[model samples]
Target: MIEILNPTSLPQARETGALVADILQTMRSRSAVGTNLLDIDRWAKAMIAEAGAQSCYVDYAPSFGRGPFGHYICTAVNDAVLHGRPHDYALGDGDLLTLDLAVSKGGVAADAAISFIVGDFTPPESVALISATERALSAGIAAAGPGARIGDISHAIGTVLSEAGYRINTEFGGHGIGSTMHQDPHVSNTGRPGRGYKLRPGLLLALEPWVMADTDELVTDADGWTLRSATGCRTAHSEHTIAITEDGAEILTVAGRAQP
Candidate 1:
């Protein structure tokens, strides 16, 4: 279902977006070597509860995943890319970690993700992967605005990843988000321009650009949720929720940036 927020609800959407961004930033700061993935989930749960917000993930039962995610946040490590279920594994030095989070507050929801190194050992390859995803995400956001098509955003994102020598995966990508975490108008990481749904004011979209270092194929882990690179190569993901407006796309989930 695609949802467009009313002007009155836009404030609530901004609040929800800020909450999600703040929580993700806090989690990233707390994450380090020896920090268990489960601990990160616990921190997210506590923060969400304290904010009087609802987790979009914990009880999520989507057809693509096992029923009831049962985790507050997704912790994708190293080769893991999407739907990363929190586990007992502790982060090691230089581990590339991705945290994806979504929450609802005041009847509005926003989703975002960030990828960063766990400790002081930042491998050059991991740094490059993370930078590529971030750049792709920026490109996608730049392509979004009223009258723009979803494919334009996807093409901009794909261009960055492809130029950076990373393989793109379309199985899971961005989507319209509002009262719910996932909605219609699926936004692939790569697509032809001038196609797909046209952007409109009051519409919220979660634009995520993720890539694997070597291959586009994915393999699910034994947990039945975590999606890893088929070749076990490292991966990175970057995302943000933005609201389309008359002027342009206003990114809602920004860590230290001003909200439009």
Candidate 2:
């Protein structure tokens, strides 16, 4: 379904987006070496409940994943990339972790994701990978505007990642997200501009560009949810929920100067 929201509804979407951003910021701040993955899930659950919002993932039982995610947040550590289910494991220094979150408030929804190193150990390559995704995400957002086609956004993002020498994976990419978490207009990380769905005001899109260090292949974990690189190469993911406006695109998820 392609769900669109008027100006008033857009505020609610921003609230949802803010909630997601705040929670991710909080989790990232509290996370460190020896922090347990399950503990992070617990923190997310508490925060989501406190916000009086609903989690789009807990009851998510799509064909691509095991029924009913039954978790508050996705924790993809190191090799893990997408749909990372929480488990009993402690974070280690230099571990690359990706946290993806989505929530609905006032009947509107927003989704976003971030990747970071666990502790003081920041690997240069991992830092570069994460930086590339963020750059691609920014480029995609800049390309999104009223009357612009979705392919334009995709192409903008793809140009950044490809030039960085990372392989793009299209099996799972961005999509239309509004009343529901996932909707129509699957936005690939790489695509030809001037093709696909045309953008319009009131349309909300989640543009995520993720990549594996050495290959585009992926493997599912035994838990049936976490997606990892086939070659066990480190990975990174960056995402944001954007609203197309009459003038341009508005990014719903972003942190203040104090946030890192």
Q: Weakest 10 consecutive residues, lDDT, candidate 2?
A: 251-260
lDDT (C-alpha) at residue 43 in model 1? 98
Best by lDDT: 1
Model 1: per-residue Cα lDDT over 1-260, one tens digit each: 77878888877888888989999999999998999999999999999999899999988999988789999999999999998999999999999999999999889889999999998998999999999999999999999999999999999999999999987888999999998899988999999999999999999999999999999999998888999999999999999999998899998996654233
Q: Which stretches in model 1 have alpha-carbon errors above 4 Å?
A: 256-260
Clashes of 1: 0
Clashes of each: 0, 0
RMSD of 2: 2.3
lDDT of 1 at 225: 95
User: How does each model score on TM-score?
Assistant: 0.97, 0.97
State each model's CA lDDT, in order. Answer: 0.93, 0.91
